[model samples]
Target: MLILTWVFVVTAGLALAYAAASAIGAWRWSVAARNLVAELTAGRVAPAASRHHAAELAGLPAPVQRYFRAALTDGQPIVTAVSLTQSGLFNMSAVADQWKPFTATQAFATARPGFVWDANITLFPGVPVRVVDAFVAGEGLLRPTILGLYGLGTLQGTGEIARGELLRHFAESVWFPTALLPSQGVVWQAVDDTSANATMTDGPISVTMLFRFGVDDLITSVSVEGRATTVGTATVLMPWECRMSNYQTRDGMRVPLTGEALYITPQGEKPYFKGTIDTIVYEFAP
Candidate 1:
């Protein structure tokens, strides 16, 4: 009886220590996220008066110009930041064995190219897992915590991960139409009548994406070469694509409300993330 009691005491103490550590880690992460959002908000560039002018599309490819016209009005306010909610199925394995249903909320800042996504995955009847994926100020981080007590996994990096995340932010601009407008650090070149290439440079990171448009002048897909994808324990650079569909108007702008992300593997194309956007709210600098 005494031995059992002693074992119980030790186990309880260990669990307490783990809980305390997890709490501390979560607190630090929350504080860092808040500080990052504030810093980016303050550094946002002021929008130009001619941002929505038709003349601003002069040097852009014709298809790119048409996409702007289809997605935005003559004087839509440029979106500096956006908040959105999404529901989707997130795959847990590369073999497509397990898929978990999830709902997430994301905040994105275009001025500096950063985003914070928080998701809750339903894994069991009474328990849920929380995941956070974010890129801020040239840093990329992914953290998954179970029951707010134990961290399942964490991936944090700066160089390639940061660049890839920046590319992601640029591609996701499909949901924030005004973000694709001609900007100081952004340039568009024609690929063909159905496609264009966009190069976005933010500080030391420069990434380009090929944008494919449909007959209606809406973006159908965005593809990037040498994008990073995690395979096994190693991160591999590969061709990646995001296919958009279900066009709808949100807050006076046409945007894609549904999409999926696929990695073009040597074997074939494998799609991993699928999501439906429920709401999008734009925030502009005053």
Candidate 2:
């Protein structure tokens, strides 16, 4: 009786396993179709979805359909204003009580070869002042403006911080050479742009990204929690928080300028960085 029962259990398990595989396969295939469609859109095969498909997709949820529409649009790199709150450990500014936090604004003008990320900042009190800077993302790069009134000057030769370096030193003390490339894919979930739950792993080291945002996806906050797993040791973890929000769009793209980032070191010391821009109003030349 025992032997017969074992045989039956094994047989049933195989059947269930087969069924599960079939289900997952079907799901993956569906996802593949969408991915293929996305790639096609990226490659300029079809700038707009066929009318029939667009109508069919309209039957889905609004956000999903919005994403679908965005995907179908021709690979005209989106040009929008990015107003980011600039702050960092290097700042000599203070966070006064009942006073506003560190903030700035930037005009994100994007095109093919590169995008010009221009920044403006007002770091003085009682004095209405602004600074401007432009950086090209694809081809033509802009130079960071010099804040004449304030002694704090732009990082001497860093007009265009390479995307590779930006993604690497994102929250790290310094840039890491072996950081994963952008093509790896970025998956982000948020309780708002101010607070987010994210995970990006390259190899042995896994980085946890957390953030806080202003009401309208103005990233008024950011946090990158790090975890280190060693061969024979327990894991090491850390936490920090920053906030930013407020924006001005030059084109149709929305950019968040009022933002902050909180950093905690391995030994547990807190630090903050904020984006600094003076004026940010988007105007489309073309």
The reply for model 2, stretches above 4 Å from the true place, is 1-184, 189-208, 211-220, 227-240, 265-269, 279-286
Name the candidate that leads on TM-score: 1
TM per candidate:
0.85, 0.33
lDDT of candidate 2 over 40-142, digit per residue (tens): 2333212111122344443333333343243333222322222233432233222322223333322232111112222333345432222322223211221
Residues 207-249 of candidate 1: C-alpha lDDT, one tens digit per residue: 8999999999999999988888788888899999999999998
Provide the lowest-lDDT 10-residue window in model 2: 173-182
The per-model lDDT (C-alpha) reads: 0.81, 0.34
Give, for candidate 1, the lowest lDDT window spanning 10 residues. 43-52
Model 1: lDDT equals: 0.81
After TM-score superposition, what is the CA distance of residue 269 in candidate 2 from its true location, in Å? 7.0
As for model 1, its CA RMSD to the true structure in angstroms is 3.6
